[model samples]
Target: MNTFLNTLNSNNMQTKKPFKNLKIFASGFLMLTGLVATAQQTTGDVVKKADVDPGTTITDGAVRVIDNKGTIKYLQTQNGITMLSNTTANVTTTTWQLGGVLTDSTFIDIDGKLFGLNGLELIDAATESASTDATTESDAGTGTGYTILVRDEATGATKKLLATELIQSGQEAFTATLAQTTFALTGAPVLPSFSQVWVYRNGAKLIANVDYTVAASTVTLVENDYAVYAGDIVEIQYVK
Candidate 1:
């Protein structure tokens, strides 16, 4: 009876040890689960509070800010909104204007690149000043009238004219003597006066009773004005 009691006691003790170990393992697992849940809750709260709205304006006078780091920004105007900067700016009804004249500087347009006007006189890169005045002469002279010479810088070609006035009264015979130039006549077919001579290249109307002759590469236009007042257009044009 004593031996049997002792063995029973030993088995009970072994069983109690396994139950204690199981209790300890269960407590540790609960603690680890609680810690993980707390960390997840804190992370969720941080994410909710860190969210922000995007910016709207990019450039206003001096300030330069973008809406998003990777997304494209836009510019808003009275006409419409546009995507600007590295992207395209699609505007509506509004055109950009350069308030001041740009001198001695180049500018870029929608076409990529272009030249600007410079110097005392506005001269474009494509076209230049045709002639420069040397000296003013009297309207009356032995050679019909005053002479105005136009020189082309590119080709070194010169055009000369005997500037005579247009008279409305009695028949006035006006003549234009060109140096090494011939003009093709069309329209009303009238001769050109001094002031009207420039109108030739200006693309104006030609009057009547106009006679032209080309000799030794020189051209002369004779006009007999029976009627017609000053400022009446009588022009002609020449090539080469």
Candidate 2:
């Protein structure tokens, strides 16, 4: 009976030892689980105005990602969230005054000036500056009495004068002296060269190098056409 009693007690002790060890292991597992929960941080249903501290940080090359199910909602590297649908609205403090696609008809507003896709200003206003005095081609006119814009080579400003005020079709009329052969072309734009000089005698066009020859700014008629009377009309046509 004593020996049987000792064996029974020994078995009980062995069984209890395993239970104690299991209890210690369960306690250690529970403590480790609590530590793991503490290490993870979560943003609950409430909106946070101030910055919330995450208990643990990610290592190098690892970034925190916000996702719904498997789809990514936001990435840490990008400026804004990855939009999944149009139903959600994201508000940010960032803003810009100028932005538009080149293919779109909308203009990009820079300050108050709006520019088109071609980089042309859409706004119409007065002159860019008082000194500019610029005029578009629309401001020009043709025919008699109409004024045309001309740039003054001296001052480099655009000025306007009647079309009639310009040289008459590049033609200058002169009264020839009695039997004058050599005539000085003082009104010619520059010294006339060779065939560029076209001479007319009394409404008749004279052949160049046949009836007359030009040298420097002077035109000398051939001996046959040299009989220019005092009252004869001589006309010189040239290109400027």
Candidate 3:
């Protein structure tokens, strides 16, 4: 009976010893796993907060950003910063002033041909005059009206009439007489007191009856006819 009791106690001791060893091994493994988890967390935090070193070389496709004042700068290279592609930046204010009229000397460098208001019309510089007649029982009289000539400033160039010349009697004004078309001024034997006749080309009125006369195909006017005359002033404008 005593031998059996000693054998049973030894068996109990062996079982208890293995159980203690298993508990200690389990505790050690748990501590090792916890230490590995803590190390990973510390490394991640350091990486997140650390600045990129200047000596570090980044390959293509790597991206980094910098905050400068209110602008966000993108790192294009190790030492260079640039605005990001397709990003809009703020601009400053600007002012503008009105410029005066352009002159002929202004340089125009546009493609194709250039034209201006003067290019549309031909101008003449010759002066011309026409006659007006009024006849009464006691008086058979003729008065004259003059025209100022404006010609193309360019040499050998001809100008076309901008507007036709007309005759006015009382409240009636004659229709425009076109160039190369003949029309006669036929009226009562008596001429109206305010028989104001005039001519125009391009909105400019010609000088009254003192300077112009019509020949077969051309109109001629002398410079002296521009002087104001004692008789009536008539306006005649012509262009060819």
- Each model's TM-score? 0.15, 0.31, 0.14
* Top lDDT model: 2
lDDT of 1: 0.33
Q: Estimate every model's Cα lDDT from 0 to 1.
A: 0.33, 0.48, 0.32
Task: Tell me the tens digit of each residue's lDDT in model 2 across 1-240.
Answer: 233224336556564553464456445545533433422233565222222112222211112222224342221111111112112222111111122222212211245666335765543235321212323433323222334568678855556754444543366778888988887767544544656778899989888888888776677888673578897888887753
Worst 10 residues of 2 by lDDT: 77-86
lDDT of 1 by residue, 1-240 (tens): 233225336556564553464456445544533422422323333221111112222221111112223333222211111222211221111122222222222312325556445564444536533233323432333232234456556754454643332232112222334332244443324543433342232233343225444433233444434233343333444322
List, residue by residue over 110-166, the lDDT tens digit for candidate 3. 347573445543333355334233222222233333222344566433333312334
**Stronger candidate by lDDT (2 vs 3):** 2
- Distance (Å) between predicted and true CA of 237, model 3? 13
CA displacement after TM-score superposition, residue 204 of candidate 3 (Å): 2.9
In candidate 3, what residue range of length 10 has the lowest lDDT sum? 87-96
